[model samples]
Target: MRIGLAPEVSAALRTDPGMLREVNEDAALAEYPSYLVADGMGGHEAGDEASRAAIEAFASVIRPGEVSTVRDVGIALEAAREAVGRVAANRVRGAGCTLTGAVLVQHEDQVCWLVLNVGDSRVYLHRGAELHQVTIDHSLRDEMIAGGAHLDALPGRNVITRALGSADTTADSWLLPVEDGSRLLICSDGLTTEVEDQELRAALTMGGQPEAVVEELVQRANEAGGHDNITVVVVDVLSGGAAWHVGVDSASGSLAESANEEDLTITATVPRRAR
Candidate 1:
């Protein structure tokens, strides 16, 4: 598929010094299409470091000129988790982070996108006129809702139950088929917590380019309070042609477009899935 990507990452207000609202990280395999996002947790500077560390660990494998696979992606994530755990174990006094990511792997005659996560970060698929959040939140509110809680009661009730570098280390991953023209939106809690799903649906349904979608999503988050670091990555699968799998590269550049603009990091790859 022709996958076009756009991403953004922002810090919170001037309140918490050096404390980003969210940390944005992604991985695009060299032989397969993959994407990732990590939201960190630690006090101020420590939290930012933890998130950046996880991203660096994952990026090491999917960086330009590296050959990677579905298995490689998983291994890379595991390494990232382990590395973060070790760092938090030695460096900080109770430091952790949440990690969420997605990868497009080829399966038989179809391409499937896998969602991997350990916290409240999310993966949403925009199909037709509706947007479906494929990943479940590992939080108390989500659990209560799953166990039958009122929709209105969900506000301020759902709190993260699992996160990377946190007390929990296990990450739940889901596999979804990648159809032609499917659009995948992955973001940190900063964006989702503030922006309403209906508004999110409207923005994604606008069918704008990936760049424009990121802009709108950021704006929505800021309007919602910008209480935390906001990060978003939008990937649109343009075609089903297998020929698009060859020739992939990681483009490095600053993502900030304005004071509210976020820091965006993108790594693109197309590799064969290893059995």
Candidate 2:
């Protein structure tokens, strides 16, 4: 990211309403241990309320600048689901939201990224010229694609199968070790639908600060016809990294100290089962 190597400056976050939308219904956070984006769906008021409520839950459980545990995130996730459910309960149309992000947590006494996703918002691992999406979309079109149907044959892409405020609040997750110089992108659909992955790849590979890259992404999306609210967060695994890995080498200060996060450290999480 563009932030200096002060360790605490590990990420950059940005959000815009886009050219067509009057009110932005997206929310994001770049707090240490957690970086996420929420795409609120429904009317402007309901959508915005749902997204903000979801983010507030994280802010309540995962203290800023502290390392988080799986239990902490789990609690926050449940709270978020409940908050969104309340929003949906009141709205006639039923409010809901898509949430996707990564949490730095202690699993098995090691630092690991707990990547999670619900609905269609995404988390992508941007390495060099390639952009690898790490989250499985819980949308109708994506479900069809997963079922071996062609993209062109699928229905509208916005019909999400799962979301907060829905019957199922389960979120899919994976545990990943921190890789030095690793760059991750947590964004809403505004960015993906408007700007092609090829364009995103070029911007991510071009060595610039996260701020610049985020601006460019939003700019491209707007230029391409911003159909929805856009939110982007760039999280850098290591600022002044040296083969950083979040496991045994962390005690030697090889990879763990790169983030310089001492408040809450991650433990090992194998088998990838995080409720």
Q: Evaluated with TM-score, which candidate comes out highest?
A: 2
Where is the poorest 10-residue window by lDDT in model 2?
248-257
lDDT per residue as tens, model 2, 1-275: 12222233378898999998898889998988789999997453489989999999867888778667666777777778889988888988888888889987665555667777888988877655556777777888978887899766999878888888776656776666566677888899999988877787788889488888888888989999998899999987654333543332122111232222221222232321111
lDDT of each: 0.59, 0.75
Report the CA-based lDDT of candidate 1 relative to the real structure.
0.59
lDDT per residue for candidate 1 within 123-222, as digits (tens), equals 7867656677766678888788778988877756236778767766666655455554657788877777788788888888894887788777877788
- How well does candidate 1 score on lDDT at residue 38? 68
Model 2, runs deviating above 4 Å: 1-9, 43-45, 239-275
TM per prediction: 0.71, 0.83
The per-residue C-alpha lDDT of model 1 at residue 222 equals 80
Quick one: best lDDT, which candidate? Answer: 2
TM-score of candidate 2 against the unseen true structure = 0.83
Model 1: how far is 216 from its true place, Å? 1.0
